[model samples]
Target: MIIPEKFNAFRIHQLEDKQIHSGFEQITLDDLTDGEVVIKVAYSDINYKDALAATGKGRILRTFPLVGGIDLSGIVVSSIDGRFKTGDKVLVCGAQLSELYDGGYTEYARVKADSVVPLPKGLSLRDAMALGTAGYTAALAIQRMEDNGQIPERGPILVTGATGGVGSFAINMLSNIGYEVVAFTGKTEQADYLTSLGASKLINRHNIEMGSKPLESMQWGGAIDNLGGETLAWLIRTTSIWGNIASIGLAGGIKFDSTVMPFILRGVSLLGINSVEMPLSVRQQAWKRLATDLKPTKLHFIAPTTITFSELPSAFDAYIDGNVTGRTVVEINENL
Candidate 1:
């Protein structure tokens, strides 16, 4: 295959007035930085962080005219490194892509060969992006929780922000792994969808809201929290003895008001999940789990929409507005 001299990208630029500009534009080979592998991007997926970078809401982008996508699955077009060669299917997510440099929101992505993962056996490229950073992060959280002594027999595991990408996949993966998952979401209307993903019980968001007292009745044995502020504090307060709460996101608020009582008295543990800057060895373990035991059986049911590259901008709006229900897959190179 002949690689093109220029390709299309969803570029984000910081303008002279200190504003953000993001949209699809043509870019050349000269635009990309040096890398050992040049991939023909097959598919990419949207994450909450990508939304922040695109909309200028979260200050996720550190440079201008940078392509803003955090997850990519594609085939290598060329490689200077011995680990991968031309035509090898690969995936890359959260090695600082779309932050300090251009990322996967393009027809082609040039990233260091060290950052890529050879696509795991038993998973398709489409399904890989369907899992994407969201699925991978969810996997990492559960793995950490299990490592810290969380188990299905301990009791129910609560998943906050259950309608979002990470939360949805968390519900599915945890349930598939034999844990009783309790999904917490403001969108109670999506209860059936959550149930189909194997949630044992669906709780309204108000249930976890900050209340007058700091501590509440003992509830879940473990939790995967995405909201991160008051909900996490509540998890710490309400979890069973020796329970674990893996905090995955800060979309609601960054800081939480809480004392150390939960930690000191109840022995509850808080695990922070970070997909970015994860070593490739750990990433491989996560992906292997994703392809096997932790793989969502009804992946398409969990993430139903697949959009063309042109529709990504509007999809970005829907994502920021909390209108997107599941993972939004963007097809960059259709042949894959």
Candidate 2:
């Protein structure tokens, strides 16, 4: 493929032993990695990982002078694969797009043909970006729980980190599907917002005590936990017998000091969820669910405050400070 002469990209360039990413001067398609399809990106969204890349806080960029968004939705401007053609609408997420490859923080992106998913019939490109990686992860978690035999009639389920992107979507999707949802959040101020998202009860994050007890009173029938630390361990110990707990993010920390008594004695299960390496089939199913059963009635309420190309940098900072709520999508290409 002939690389275009000019394109726009948000790039992280090395400067004085540091990396900085923001709106910069025009970049060429020549700067992108080789792929079978070239997309004119319509929308992209900020994730926790995107925040790290924009701020250079983590080693999210495997290479420098890279575009930083991990997810995007767009129209294929050109394609080498017969399965896709020029002008095809599609979306992409969780395929090392930002970390190991040139990504969607640009006006155009060249992506491997197999890594893309066709936009679902009922979903618009803008709505796909609004759901983004967070909503997809939440849907995957819910699917896993159901596949593992979890049912709403068993008991009330718990959602930790309830105000963030994944958590907000999980709460609404679960509750909308007839499950009783108890939401936990550090932000007491967001109680009304969580309630509006269909959370049945709000549990104070501080009140979710993590003590030395190896086990505690049985509580949740199932759980979708985003923060994975002592809180996760506590959730493991307290989940009802034969319940499923899907462990997603690690904003709290990674280490889990847990006991096997919950597994052996209570038959509880801890399912680790990695949205990044999800197989293509599972990814397709998850997004289909997002457009159907797991779709949240109040999805717009969980959007990352929409921003333009120029406002992305500050939005990234707000995400890092934990000040942002739900999903934050960047509108590009005339909001198509």
Candidate 3:
């Protein structure tokens, strides 16, 4: 495993007019921000947030000319972090990569020692990237739900955005752990794919009418909602007594208009999952669970589609339009 002295990274530069232009650019090892370890990055994956950052649609980067990827997996070639050594395998997710810091879109990534996690034994590099932030969020959602008393024997668990990475993995993992999962998706065409991932039933996104009513009939025992706003509000209303709902993203919107009826009457718990600033112990625990108990048997069900660094600009458009499905991996450095 040879680490590149000079590497390629997808760099986003903001021009004077405040427009962002992103492309593949040559970068040197010395150009990366200082960190305790440098990884010979093998694979990186795109997330909805990554798409936003690349296009400058969101204020994803706190700085200019930043690398634009949120997740990475590979082997360590150098380490000042005593926990890691040369040739040791590892993967990093969250810990503000690509947000407040330079990140994984490059052939090499130098990250703070505290943010790195050793790759779990059973997972390959590809597997770790496949899980990436999406699967980690899914696990966090489920873990929160369980911590709040959700159980397989408690009727059905609903996973919104079912065709997307987080929802897809949530459905598969929840079902594999013995809970019946009902998936919600706008892509009706992906019905078979969702079912294959263990969704016991599918709800058309359009059919779940967003009413302003304070409460609705309790329909589900628990929910893992990636789309926030009205969908989350709706889920809260219809959740059974003592049910838990994990809110992970705002793909739908940021605001939620709901009343306290669900909480005060039904005792519904709305757990907010912040994958970015998770404690190191919890991060390690989640990855270990991803390698074991909460691991999805149909992990390849969310198989990644590879794209070169050069193709990112065009691929990003597709991502924002909700036209891309499953995970998309970028081949950063060569492996032989």
TM-score, each model?
0.96, 0.96, 0.96
- 108-151: candidate 1 lDDT, tens digit per residue: 99898878999999999999999998999999999999889898
Model 3 C-alpha lDDT per residue in residues 1-336, reported as the tens digit of each score: 566567789888899999988888889988787799899888888888899999988788888878889999988989987899998989999878877778899888899989999999899888888899999999988988898899987779999989889998998899889999999988999999999999999999897776677989889999999889889989998999999999988888999889898899999999999998889999999999999988888877686487776676778888888888788877776671
User: Whole-model Cα lDDT per candidate?
Assistant: 0.88, 0.86, 0.88
lDDT of 1: 0.88
lDDT of 2 at 43: 93
Candidate 1 has a TM-score of 0.96
| lDDT string, candidate 2, 1-336, tens digits | 234689678877656757564455588877888889899999999998998887877778877777879999999989989989887899999888888888888888999888899999888888898899889989999999999999987789999989888899999999999999999888889988999999889899887566667778888999999989888998988899899999998878999898889999999999989888888999999999888888788877788367887777777777778777778889767756
Worst 10 residues of 1 by lDDT: 206-215
lDDT of 3: 0.88
**Model 1, which residues run further than 4 Å from truth?**
207-214
